[model samples]
Target: MTMFSTIRLRAAAVLASFALALSGCFLSPGKFTSELVFTGPDSFTFSYEGEIFFLGLSKLAQMDAAQAEFTPPECYNQETYESQECSAEELADARANWESGAADRAAEAKKKAEQMAAMMGGIDPSDPKAAEELVKRLKRQKGWERVVHKGDGVFDVSYRVTGTMGHDFMFPLIEGFPATNPFVQTFVRQGGQVRINAPGFATQNPEQAGMGAMMGIGSLAGLAAMRAELDGQGDAMPGIPVIDGTFTVRTTRGMRVLANNTDEGPEPNNTGEALTWRITTRTAQAPTALIALIP
Candidate 1:
């Protein structure tokens, strides 16, 4: 449900991370309630019941058709490093150059989209039945309990995934879709430790932000370059639906919750403690935690 700078429609895919700026983009969240509950050191249950927005099927993909008013290119002095007024001839040349490349850019964008479509279960975004095909694919999967195409790349659905933490895990993972940046994650570590980070659910996660900086993806707007386009709650992008929800992490007693950003920290439950994050459009830091699981 998001992308990158100026979002050259050609490269955006969920049909764009498993919705990265690359070919396998991940879906953006709409309104919903989700939770991650840890019953034991080696097991967990994660469920997402809400709306997921697909970029290829949304107004975003049509951005190419929305041409902007051309602005005269500025001329700068190379030697003195100062701004200079452009000659009428220079302006004409610039306009001519940009106009000449419009068709090429549009074509490249379409080709990129088609390439993405091939990996996205082979259903073209241009096809009227694309959304229905997507629904069928999700229905055929194991965790996608319900999927309803609401048109324009949006779907109302319920998804639940559970498994032992012997290995890493990702959510909203389709049968044939290549894995990109996931909406949620649970990674098992060396000493019965587990990590939880949901970049898609948040505007930005602190650790990933630092990593993004190191990787040259400096958008504080979120996890990757594409997240800036989605902006989690869609504050930066107005047309997209609001991303509002709750992520509750419940763990068994004695499980050490080492790190988190919950408003009041973890709360007590019958067997253990509960950590809750009240996600909103303005959620600056993505929800995260490091818990050393109890054996």
Candidate 2:
């Protein structure tokens, strides 16, 4: 499939994963809040915070209990092909191999546990309270050094990125979507300044402009069919709680704000060295957001 088609498939996979994880608790379309702060010429901080209300506290408790009892099976713990689909004979072979490597696997697991304990400030996994501690840690945001749970299902998370922007800006997506896509434009750094452009909803592109601009009429028709399927499937799903949030961008010191298309929040401020752009919206099945930053 084409890059855009792959991205759409990955988006669908993400939605499917979310649905499975929160199957007990319905989720409504929710808001997604994000913030991008430029700290220096080659450094920036990104934060995304949002909330999804559960039907009741019981759902949250159930989720916590499920995670607390979670453990990797031998197939996952071992570095063997047992994790993959196998024939009956192959499965027997893998089981035998795993049994033979039990000692080595135990050593690896112990080493990994030690590392985890060190990172977690000496919290021993063997302790009775370890499961609870792990549950708390898992509930925190991923990829963020600091994550604050603001109660009522809200969370605030932030992470800093330094050095080159390059392709590092795009985090790994679900299966099918490659890290590189036309929608993600590469940033070029010049002197002390860097410019990046993110496509907006109304942005014009030859591939998506019209049927005449498409590679072929079949491609255009296929895209339409896929979109229709997605819409129908979305409508069929149970209505879940929605989340609404805002995203803001603030330029760092010594950096001049160039141009941005994001809407202003309650207090608009765009006429200074440090400008802000705010976008507030509801989340979707395959959500996509874009922004342009030149510093």
Candidate 3:
């Protein structure tokens, strides 16, 4: 597999794990509320407040184990997986088995850790310090300043990125793995306004894109089932994992939205100042939701 394909496969595995963990639950992973307040033509205050639900204690343990087992290769560590001399076959195998291997390895590690914990009289799930090490690991990133356990399988985290917006700002929801799953909610600035470009997942790989199109068609079929279930026209189909979120943009005082591709969220106010794009279900759509603003 090519480097890009490897990256895409890695991302798919992580997302698949997330979906399984959040399946059948009302809370899907976590809710993110972010604000991008433009301070100048080229600068902004990026604040994000969110929580990531672990679902169960075992899930947390599994995540820790998976992270330990899957340390990125030296080439990946240097952000040059494509150019490095790493064995392509090794990378291909890793990608092929990442999902199942992650689960199996995590289960084995969890079993061993459980045995040790039993001998040590077990660790309290409610112990704040239990998650401290993981929090520290997460905070090692440049913009992540705070990551705290907020009780009940939830983690309260916040981060800020401040500077002139370069070509684009990418916030990797999952990093350190083969594919850094960065979510780019903001686009290149164009004369006092920012554009919302296509999401990376939509174009990560041609094969994946084609697969996504097929999945989208499947989702439409699922949607029909959902409507039928609501109307008592048919039985409910298996649920598709739907990742949902909202992106809010606040331009400088005098700026306003110029154009948008989505009508899911409220339109720019009469003052033409701000807009929010609500991503209801980011399963297989193009993933590109554009919005341009201008002063």
lDDT of 1 by residue, 54-135 (tens): 6667665655544444557657566664667877887888788879888876786777577658657577877888788888
Q: Which is the leading candidate under lDDT?
A: 1
Q: Model 1: how far is 16 from its true place, Å?
A: 15
TM-score of 3: 0.45
Report lDDT (Cα) of residue 271, candidate 3: 38
Candidates sorted on lDDT, descending = 1, 3, 2
Expressed as tens digits, the lDDT of each residue in 2-106 for candidate 2 is 012333453343233332322221211124455556555566666544432221121222222232332322222134423343455655665666567667656
TM-score of each: 0.71, 0.34, 0.45
Whichever of 1 and 2 has more lDDT, that candidate is: 1
Candidate 3 — which pairs collide? none
The deviation in Å at residue 106 for candidate 2 is 41
CA lDDT of each prediction against the hidden true structure: 0.67, 0.36, 0.46
lDDT of 3: 0.46
Q: Rank the candidates by TM-score, best first.
A: 1, 3, 2
